[model samples]
Structure formats: structure tokens, C-alpha cells
Target: MTDFPEIAAANPAFFVERVLSVHHWTDRLFSFTMTRPASFRFRSGEFVMIGLPSEPGGPRPVMRAYSIASPHFAEELEFFSIKVPDGPLTSRLQRIQPGDPILMGRKPTGTLVLDALTPGKRLFLFSTGTGLAPFLSVARDPDAYERYEKVVVVHGVRQVSELAYRDLWTREIFEDELVGEQARRQLVYYPTVTREPFERQGRIPDLMASGKMFADLGLPATGFDPAVDRAMMCGSMAMIKDVAKALEGYGLTEGSNADPGDYVLERAFVG
Candidate 1:
């Protein structure tokens, strides 16, 4: 018998995916991969609803929006989660193991996707905390590299330990046979920490304001040309606001699926 009755499997609108693996990054953070339903499809930077059954015999389940962390080409789906104590969904989500069932929403949608941004020479993906989840998908997608000459990633976290997927991004993805040439010449990684001491430490906005981030990347501090630099921001409401404000000074407009523009903004978390 299954650990829990697969109500989602019976429902045509949902897919009950089996857990493939889980990795713990810290007490408060973790990531897991699950089998992807053959019929399920989504863009690289979209968010989908996920959850465990409300109860063993309960028909309802508690679900929350989570960004799909893996690339669009991957056969399996992956997610980075914040392991909150007693959180309505994550409290139970953190314990999932191989063979466990997890419900996935049929439609994955979000504004952080590349479809919302206008064509440009450089693509800047800014994220913080669990917000890095969606960009993980974007960064790995070969389409992103083909669309722009350069892809700059800026991920901010509290400490060095919270930096997830550094090795994966630097080694595996960047050095992939298909995209290695462009990734080596175009992928610029700028990771920073706010509370802990590290080589680069500061709020992303602060670093951007001080020109240090651009200097480190060997790009001109004033080279944030609205005509060439297209950006996407995923993080807390405050972080998004701060970033949008900075980008607006350069005349970049916020974009949507309906109308592509110079920049795109989306909240990594709600409430």
C-alpha cells in the first residue's frame, strides 16, 4: 500500500510526483528532486503549487507556491525550500524522502520568466534567500545563454553556508558541453552575504550603488545601459522594491507576459 492514498493521482488536474532525492543545506534550508509527470510542462522560471496531504485520510491538502529550481530540460523537477518550524506546508515538506508522494499544480506560472523581458545584450538575475530558486532554473536553461551575450547572477544570503548550488553553477552547469563556451565567456557570478564576513559582503542594492559589484565583474560601474542591460528580480517585497527603484533610474520598465519590457520583477515570497 502507498504511504498515503494518492488523491492527486485520481484528480486529473494534479500530478502526484514521487520524491527522487533530498539534500540538506542547513537546518533552515533544503532542496529535493521529484519525478516529473510526463505531461507536465513549464518554463524554467515559473512557480508551482506543492504540498502534502492534509491528513492520511483527508481529501484536502495544504499547498504553497514554490519556484521550480531545476532547468526546463531536466527530466525531474527540483525545489529549494525554507524549512520553517510549524509552517503550514514546509514543516512537513522538509521530511520528504524517496518514494514519498508530493502534489504538484497542473499549471506553473510566474513573471520572473524570460518571456517577460525584452531582448538585450546582458541578462541580470538578482535574487536573495530562497528567491534564488527560480534563477537556478533560468541559469541552467541553455535558452538563456543563447538569448543574451552575457548572463550575470547576483545571489544574496545571510551567510556563506546558505549559498546553495555554488559548485553546481560554477562547475557542472557552466562547464556543460553544450553551453560551456558561452557560459565561460558570458556567465558572471556575484554572490554576497549580509550578516557574515566573506570576500563579498553587503546588501545587493548597496553593492550596486557602490559600483563594487560591477567593478568585480569588470563591467563599467556606469554601464547599466537601459538599452543593453535587461534585469529580472526575485526576492522579498522589500528587495524587489529596492532593486526596481534602482533600475528605474536607468529607465528600465517592469515587464509582464502581456508586454515585454526592459526589466521584470516578482516576489519570491508572499505575506
Candidate 2:
């Protein structure tokens, strides 16, 4: 496996930079925006390694790969994170405030971008938890609407409270009079809570299995040809596996940076 040079060096001082802003969504979730170095550039759906300075003068740093939540045009970088009580990165990261230093990497790379898929009539973005980050980037880009006649973003969370930014953005973008007309006609936001009662309640796999998702959207459950539909998935390992299997039955093939196809899959976190 290839090891990241800075992380492999285990040097905190060289990588640390000050934080810019922080917004807490729930007890377990928050989003922060940080200054992007002048030289930093990334595609819409890529991720970068981030870390927090360990000690005042210590060398050890806590680092992990985080998907870029802000669009490419944004001046600052943004990340949506979950607070794991004892997670090496989030344990200290969750306590950060503006002016504090957070280490960041130079390059950003991933396989979740819209360019990785062929043009289709409809685009489906399926996510859970922080997995919704990349889709947030894609939905904000006008090119996505131009390429796909219809866009459906389905987010499955453990609770309604966990559906923070996704719900906020969907409402904002689809309601703005300037963008609302196009977004309203082309975009569909489907939110499902696995642990809470809401308009929709169930895992994404279950929704697909029972045809409720398609029926609600007035779409056909089967016969998903690559020419008309494309999909992107990001979530836990189990969710990815289950959703991929379900898509396969409908004739979707997984795509990647090297080979563009009908669908793409990415994990929200290593764990």
C-alpha cells in the first residue's frame, strides 16, 4: 500500500494550519470550513488527508481522509464530520474552534465525480451519514442539471436530526426562485430514516427491494439501462455492498476514475 509522505513522516508542525469556522449540526455531527491555500485545487468529488496538531511541540498527529464538502469554486474548504467518542481524529477535532490549527494535505483525489459517469437522462445520488458530502458538491453544480434531465438524491440516516446539511441544502437550492424552477422540475430529494419515523422510514436497500422508492417517484423499478440512468453511492461498507448488489440486479455496472461506466461507489470513512 502507498503511504502518505507527510503522515508517514509523523510531523505535526509542518502540516498544521489554523481553523476558519465551525458549525455544529447535532451532538454527533458538525461541519467546519477552513482557509484553502492559494495553491490548493481539487475536483468536485475528491478527498484529502486532514489532521489535528497533537501537542504544542509533539510530532504525532491524528489524520484521516475527508471528502471535500464545498464546491470547487468556493474559496474555502469544507468538511462534514461525525463525532466518534474516541475516534483518533474526531475526539480532538470535534472541540476545534476558529483560529486553531488543523493539518491538511496538498492533493485531493477520488472516484465519485460526475465526469466519471457517462451522460444519462437521470442521475441518482444515494448516501447515508457523512456520505452525503460529495452529493452536496454535485447538486450545487449547475452542470449536473444540464447533463441529466432528472436528479434524485436519496439520503438515509439513522435519525431525522442526522439529516442536517442534506435537508438544508435541498430546501434552499430547490426553493430559490432563481434556481428553484429548474431544481424543482429536475431534482428530487428523498430522505429516509432508519431509526426514526418520518415521511419515509427504512434502509435504502429495503426501499429499492419493495419498489416503494420507484413507485413514489413514478419511475420504473426495473429496466435501468445505462443510457437513461447513472448512480453514485457513498456510505458504510454494508450499505455500499447491499446497494451495489441491488443495483446489479437492475443492470448497473460500477465505474471508477480509470473506467467510466454506469455507477460509482465510495466509502464515507475507512472505518
Candidate 3:
């Protein structure tokens, strides 16, 4: 038998009840929204553990950390998830529907947030796969525009069908005449795909390596300064490491809750 934490003693206490609504973006990607408990509070970029009710005579519920996709002030909590065919949690999770019960952990925590970085003029949110979730929250927050002059969100996926949320979000933020005027001028959504032909192709690390990203943005490569720029990275472990090393070459340092710095990293999920 596996040892369970004392915190898990009362399963009902740790999990808040929620009604979920699902949206499938592709075979590998999907999103869901759940009713938020009145007392639930979290930072825009934090993640919380979520799971389904355990079956009778089965193993304890398997919970995975998911970044909050909804903005801080939103009444509902949203999550973007990858559907791994045989994943312990996702196998059953992918089948959930509206009005289905979902278990949400009490505490939410992560390093990808505006408060984790020192004030800067530009904010770069680098993501791949479901790693884009936290950035979705940050970008939708009007406060993000107030703190930075520019907000650039780069999302990389395996196919065009996987780029669902970017289009809707970009249009909503950039086309809204009132709430999105500043974001329209300062926000840039750059989408890239590895296995499909799109406006941008290749992984984010490669784009940074070849200087294509900078060239396309019409920004000079010579004056890369961490002082005026802050970045957040979330994706595969390999992708995060590669991107972090690349950012380091440009003088960016990793930051955490204990210290504020030029950049921060959060894993989209435990591998």
C-alpha cells in the first residue's frame, strides 16, 4: 500500500465540488471550465491539483497540477489539458461532461505570475502544449497591460488544430474597442507549430537561436536587456531547460517567490 498524506485523510475536505463543462480543441488538446467555489482564491498564474472522484474499491484518486486558465477575478476556473490516451488521470478525465463532478484541491501555487518579476517594459510568455494555460490568465488580466508596455505571448504546438485558444483570445483582446484598446496596440500573439505549416514554424528555442523571432518582430538582436524585459516559461521539461539556457545567453536569470528577477519557469505538468 502507498502511504497517503495526512492531508488526504478527509477527501471531501480537500476537494471542493464543481460542475465542469468541456471543450475539445483537438485529439491531443482540450479545455474545461468548472464552477468556482466562493472562497477559492488564487493568483492569475498559479496551478492547483485537480482530480476526479475515486471509484469504490479502486486506488485513491490521481491528482495532477493544472495551471489556472481563467483570470484572477473570473467567477469560474478554467484549465487547458492534454489528453494522453493512457494517462492515469487524463484517460478518465477526458470523458467528463457538463454537470460532471470534479475535485479541486484547496491550495493553488506556482511561480508564473506578474508579482514574481521586477517591473519591466515588456513581458514575454513562452509556452508549448498546455503550458499556455497560465499565460491565458495573465494576458486576460487588464492589470498586465498596466504593468508593461508590451505583452508578447508565443505558443508552439504540434498542429494547427491545437492552436484553438490563441485566435479567440487575440480577437477578443485586440478587437474589443474599450477594454482592449491598449492591449490591441501592445499585445502580440505569435503561434508556431512543429509538425504543421503555419505562419511560424519550429520550436521556440530554434526561433530564438536563428534570430527569426526577433527579425519578424522587427526588434534588433543586439540590445537584448533583462533590465527592461521579463519572461515566463512553461512547457515540457526539455523545452523549459532549453529556453531557459537561451534566455540566460541573453542575460536573464530564473526567479521565484523568494526573489524577484528577470524570468520564471513553471512546468505544465509533472512528467
Per-model TM values vs. the true structure = 0.95, 0.90, 0.92
Quantify how close model 1 is to the true structure by its C-alpha RMSD in Å: 1.7
In model 1, the clashing pairs are: none
Q: Residue-wise lDDT of candidate 2 within 1-271, one digit each (tens)?
A: 2233543366533444567899999999999998887777888878889987555467667678888888787778888899999988898899999877678877789998988998789999999899988887777667788889998888889999999776555678877544467787899899999997898999998898898988988987664566688999887877888889987888888888888889998987553
| RMSD from true fold, candidate 2 | 4.7
How large is the C-alpha RMSD of every model relative to the true structure?
1.7, 4.7, 4.2
How big is the positional error of residue 70 in model 2, measured in Å on the Cα after superposition? 0.8
Best by TM-score: 1
Tens digits of lDDT, candidate 3, 43-74: 99999999987765667789889999998998
Weakest 10 consecutive residues of candidate 1 by summed lDDT: 3-12
Clashing pairs counted in every model: 0, 0, 0
Clashes of 2: 0
Report clash pairs, candidate 3: none
**What lDDT score goes with residue 63 in model 1?**
77
Cα deviation of 112, candidate 1, in Å: 1.4
For model 1, residues 17-50, the per-residue Cα lDDT tens digits are 8899999999989999999989888999999999
lDDT of each: 0.86, 0.82, 0.84
Model 3 lDDT at residue 64: 88
Backbone clashes in model 2, listed as residue pairs: none
